[model samples]
Target: MTSTAPVPDPSPTATTPASAASRGARSLARLGVHVVGDGVDVVVLASQASAVDLVLLGEDGERRTGLLRARHGLWHAHVPDVSAGTRYGLRVHGEWNPAAGQLHNPDKLLLDPYARALTGEVSYVPEIFGHHVTDAAATHHGLEVRDDRDSAPFVPHGVVLPASDPVATAERLAARPRVPWSRTVIYEAHVRGFTLLHPDLPPELRGTYAGLAHPAVIEHLRRLGVTTIELLPIHAFATEHAIAARDLPNYWGYSTLSYFAPEPSYATRASRDAGAEAVVAEVRAMVDALHAAGIEVVLDVVYNHTCEGGLDGPLLSWRGLDNTGYYLHDGGTPARYADVTGTGNSLDFRRQRVVQLTLDSLRYWAGEIGVDGFRFDLAVTLGRKAGEFEPDHPFLVALASDPVLADVKLVAEPWDVGPSGWRTGEFAPPMHEWNDRYRDSVRRFWLADAKALAQGGHGTPHDLRDLATRLSGSADMFHRFDRGPTASINYVTAHDGFTLADLVTYDHKHNGANREDNRDGSDNNLSWNHGVEGRVESGSPGSELRPVRRRSIRNVLGTLLVSAGTPMLTAGDEFGRTQQGNNNAYCQDSPISWVDWERTGWQDDLLETARHLLELRHAHPVMRPTRFAYGRPRSNDPFIDLAWFGEDGAAVEGSAWHNPYRRVLQMRRAGGAAANPRSAEGVAAPVRRDLLVVVNGALNDVDVALAPSRTQGWELVWDSVWESPRERHESAVVDGAFPDAGTVVPVEPLSIRFYLSR
Candidate 1:
């Protein structure tokens, strides 16, 4: 039951027509359902509609209708008696032409573009389509035939929420945990998957917002040293019709339905049953809890397109309100959508209305919901204007200049499936991009290269130079744009690909369960299954493969944490989580997609190594440099920022960078100088400790000569080959008994080591 408050009536006053128009325009600025004064003002943007009706469904099961007054492309109606929790929807009456891109179906109840909450879930039935589906084959062949069936029964309605709702008026907002970009360690996680199988979380709270905020979850993240939590899309989304028809769900939740509302399914059943306001309140509490723990939250937002798929898609919010205005349509045939995001349609950022909607949604989430940042899914599509991506596009410029959003982090996936979509480093400053080059290089060095060596060295495509560039923040890709190393969000694996454990246990993807006949996932996984495939039980014939795979996991985790950029770890990667080689688990809602809390002895060691690696990263500033190294010492500086050395303890030069057989290199970083010459406040920065990193990707252990540097001695701090995280091995360094510059130091095969210089 919803509680209602009494609404005050408007006072009668005489006004000129000009004054009335001015007042209506001012009211138009506040779009969607808003509790104004004492009444509910419902606003809908239907520029081409001849008439609009506000349909209300009362709790008594009675339906009431009210006509809206149209002024300047906006239809608004203020119901003085209607209070908060009023259920309503819009019915725009206009020409229902399919060929000309005017999809105004009066019989179908349309959802508001700015609706804060939805009453129910969308049921995908034939009535939801604007065109009738007489023959399924004909409909699938792109035939357009108008259907007169009403869609109110299958579509969800919008609910009016009061301004003083609990979610809107929660305890005073907490200050954002403004973790610096250099120190930011992102943990990409699914709100449900992260807590679904947690043994410590209560069953009812598991897979819900409250579960993510539970003390157990917070303690784990804090111990792991992750400063930010990047959540998959939590916006109200509907399962893809095709996937749902196959009894599968879009578990990733990329198909958004409502941008402002939190996905109600992610909330506890009790909160969901209470009302939409309860769901919002629950999400608010979770954000508050995370903030209190000094952890920032970043949402993966999908604004490139919507749930309403291509030309034959359903009549959801944007498609029904203004099809051509909201989505990009083919120039030759306006009825067909220009599919850029591979989601059937691409949002037309060229339209100011669409841009305004995106801005409004972002502002609402950042200001009201208190998210610290956003990771734009298929972000290149957002920068597309005139069928090409522009760095200074109006939408991009507006976002960069927005006062409220300027301070928050902005990350982009940086590409789409459209033309010229592989934009790895083209995004402007203040907008960090996911570095695919870094991901591929790391995978090749640790997994694919090792596999090549095992296969008689026939496929060694890269060498140590490639790994060096990625380790130093891929300056070849990002430095040209004046962006520093911090602009790179480096990760070896993410939600869309293989987990850390799977990288060394599966050479190919096992996506047969996705109903695509095993042809759905990517073919180029860049993985290796060591000596055997899949899980190896204790005492099995290939039992030795397990230890090898564990070592590979440790090496990858060590490299990722020590790399010079902002590192992001997938939720379960720190604990050796695997999806049974199922790289694409986007449709599976079972254990195949959930994070298993169960662990083996080796898995515990991996987790401990990951924790220690993150702590090491935090302790040493050289590992997370803010600026790209130039390999030359400044005039006033006592040491160079960075230098690369080959196996002979000499600087790598000439053709050595391209030598495929040379897979061993050492990096010396002069951490005594500031990672960035200047601080955020334009002042001189403090000096840090110097350090050295050694990586050997060869199949056999080799003796590596220590490079000459301006340090008295070097002490071994960490080694990836160590079986246990608690093992003390400082005696291996023998401090102050310095070896000559050309003296050899034995390095384990396929291992990485870190040393602190004194």
Candidate 2:
């Protein structure tokens, strides 16, 4: 993963609380270090740890080791004179019993999972591993050999949160942007990447949380009309061993180290130097600013797995403290882990302690840090208890019942790398799930179909059928529980795959720079390069294929914003940001991974196109229905909420719906009154309008006859053929006139046209 910038220099170790050995460990509070006036209370949950040592390091390399008393499963101690900025680490002692999964290595300094901030990076080195990971051990299977080397210097230390203000936190929460699910337009962005290269921001603020909260950045989001910014993981995360070994940082932050801590690397340099308190304050301030701007902040959280990785992975925190209790193991072989997340290890939600940690962290972020919501990565893993998904899983139920998160946004990636992991619509209501089917359908229709037809072939018969279902909020998939279109978080591109720009420019992923033989990213991208590739062959005045490619982008964006479900626009996608064809540039923490803010003419045009489409969406409630239309969809009655049609403007009934060669699709959706899910106002907001959408995926121009309606004329809202979003609809609709029923609109090949009839 390329970095937004050289991660503002590693923070210096901060001061910590004084410690006193109580002989017999006891606790008044829960796990992690807690400030109590001048003193501090520290507790660690290490059921398998035979002994626990509290190590507090000083500014000049001095260390004070105190032995904590152990109770049933908790090891705790009381320390006098709580330091405002304290640095501490825990060392657990026990026998190295691999079979039973008891990997307690006293020599390894472990991070507190609940620590609010981290002071340094976890260097990828053999000294940090619990087992003997030296070069010579490679031949002798050193992973099984318990290492005796002290890992204190190489690992990061937990920074005690300075005294906090409950009032400030409460104020932030009270001011939350609480955009209801039905009206949410999520802009999936990275805190660093979003403003890393923004020309308008101060150099000091760029790439930090402060940069994302900058007015310039906020203005862009406001102009784009995204209600919520679902930032990629901001939790304290570490680079994976392999990535670190290659001298690369973990740009995406999927390998979370502290669920409670904000990644210090993402803080401004002064804040990083100021230690944990400043880091947390910066993030909180970022949230406050976003909320002030009427934008919600949703964190992309990784509770399903950790940086500890596989069975042979390092014992950083959980593995060394409570190995068996924190992670899921094979039923028969406790030594082996169940790799459901493809990240080597998965946390065991079945364990009460694990679930408690997750809930506690969530509460801290929501109640104290004041984040708007969370988007759970690999969320299917969290719902798996007895090796299968359960919609009524304890964690899911707990989230729904939690007062703090009940109304807050809760989005699920809804799948993992495990068996039967494709549980798209399996999550219960109140938690919108990522709609990959929506993504694939849109990609196939506008992009894949174009490629197929260019080669004198046709798309599948089920293509239109699947797209129709997606456009209607995936009723065939989510209606089982009556979770409406808003339950589907619609997106055509995301951080992990090709950007919207790359999707139209690259036919295949170019990840050779990742040193993985170009085999790292997914091969089934469902993308089509418009005859030209690789950044438009720079300096070409007018690439003939450029207009067509831009039209495809507009077509896709038009489909997304106008679709029934909630939409998520990937950062930089609004202006056609490119990752240079490296879809899986997870390790490229360089310019390729960061959002390129400088835009070309076409890029700027694309951004306007995005804003125009979002304007249409925000202006009309029919564009974002909270509930599926309850009326019969197949009826030709003018009053029907949703009706499907063809090029001739007649109802596309019977075999016409399954015609393989039929590339054009017309949809007539009249927005109707439904219970607006925004309950805070005590009354349902207006969600009424009428819309006519015509999509042409065919190779040749089609004379699309407008669908007839009883009550009105259609006003042209958007046309994909325009080089500029502000450009007038040339052939699609007449200038300054509304086309009535049966009017012939000359729709372009492979384009989308949206009409307003209200």
Candidate 3:
């Protein structure tokens, strides 16, 4: 049970006024307190309390106090003088009962629900924890009844602010750097890691919000051609008890402390001194800067759980405001929480109030913070019911229907730690999901069978087709109704798995650096070490394996760029930054996870490959369609966007998919009529065109017969092995008139080729 030691006399500076409402509020805010309304019409509601006091700390550090004394069954108080920028907190008096979830003690301070700004971090000391502090006090109470040294100094203080419209902010941001879903290339990065090691960033600005907008960082992003920068969580967070004991902070910021407050550590000098407004201004400035450069900012949000732990956890904002109401209470005991996020307590979205709070928080961030979109962490759990997570959960529907959020990109991680956690491609339309299937398929098609190729067995054509579908946005995964193609957020590697460099360098997870008994990273890595692990091409330049690695990187990147859906590139992958094999570098905030801007010789080559691929994707309108054109009449474009052909120029069979020995895929892209309605008169439209993409995974060179083309002569666009501009394919024309002889295109082993029909 929570019992506070006798409260020490308030400092004369914080003495309360003797008004009746103030006295009454001071009497009733002790138990089950709920405060609502903007400044000047403050209404404090207390369910069980003897006394309550409303204390307001001004910007000048001076505090004013008003009492809220309990009366009848409900204790209510109204203060009309309160206004914005007014910092307020409550002190309540009531019976402390921990087992019954009524942890109330008049001696402790309470934070207001509608608080706009927060002052300090939640201290994990004994004063903050209910049982820990009270138990320690009980032993001292036995020794001396008058020794009232209760620790009130550790509690978090809330700051009040005048209400403002969040919608206006969103409207201003709507036109800023909004790339269509097709052209968008997302670069997922950590706010701190993005520039922590940058030499150009000032020592003071390094890793801060200001650092993100620094010229060097911006220039680097521009060079990479990323349309959107998806930052890892930057919300205020708290270190868990176990992590704190180990002296490690929550680096990822997933364990949220306050949704409204930006992580204080991310801010610069002005933000720390000027409070939450400074944070908003600085972050908005960053967004504005990115918008000028045609780049969107997508925040990785964590709303499924809070930093507050389970039963023994500290009574933070939600716990103190309404313990049993805000969290999912266990059926066996309403006092305890139903843990689902694996972060101790799960928010009860089933509660309408909790749902409202979540919706409000999203609006606040999107509208005020000026983010283009949000990537929900463990999104499935946010909509979880008794068994499975529903697609039509109230929260999901609200987000889909809410005008402010509906237009903004709503991507989901799409799974949790519960039953059926691997719910990929399940989210509704206008939403993109991380396609792990694409990651696995790309990895296996290149690296996994390379070892077998050395033994003279080429990988299967079925394997090639599987890779083909992923490259075309895995239509098999999504439904016809769910905005086909864009529904899949395709990636070969993401934050949780092996990085692009590691995916080629290591076959196993190396998480020894996590300091958690090597239990952190994943083991299902579909990587191959290419004869030697964690090193490039076995220390040989221009070796046989070098082509394989280069071709593999090119294929994955080219596939991602030309694919139907949006593509995401992990930060620093373009430069081939390797983690030495460590997949879970979440704990290691040093160079292990940070992007090394300096590129090696091989890295520069890879970067060039990526740049050329991106240019090619941008040049082709057929690659990035607004909708799946191949699907049906209702779809946008006419001709099937992509068509797969087997070795003899015939349709691939479904049963041939599992054969690993066949590894050559001929992919065709067909162009269609434009979306403009003015074409009714059959104006001279662009010629019907088709291009061929050939991938050969054999260890030795092979000959790919070019299919007879009807359009003008083909131009060589790309080849994996040769340096981009220097690589070109030209041959004698092969048409039906000259069917007696066919053109033979030399295909390099473990390489990909692109031919464009002019």
Best by TM-score: 1
Please estimate how well model 2 matches the true structure, expressed as its whole-model Cα lDDT: 0.81
RMSD after CA superposition, every candidate: 5.2, 6.2, 5.7
Residue 474 lDDT (model 1): 89
User: Per-residue CA lDDT of candidate 1, range 307-327, in tens?
Assistant: 887777777778777888889
Candidate 3 lDDT tens digits, 148-263: 23334666666654455547664666656667787888999888887887889998888888899888888878877788999898777777665665556677778877676677
Higher-scoring candidate on TM-score, 1 or 2: 1
Q: How many pairs of residues collide in each model? A: 0, 14, 32
CA lDDT of every candidate: 0.82, 0.81, 0.67
Off by over 4 Å in 1: 1-22, 61-72, 134-143, 164-174, 674-687, 730-743
TM-score, cand. 3? 0.84
CA displacement after TM-score superposition, residue 130 of candidate 2 (Å): 1.0
**For candidate 3, what is the total of clashing residue pairs?**
32
Give the range of the ten consecutive residues with the poorest summed lDDT in model 2. Answer: 1-10
Positional deviation of 429 in candidate 3, in angstroms?
A: 3.0
Number of clashes found in candidate 2: 14
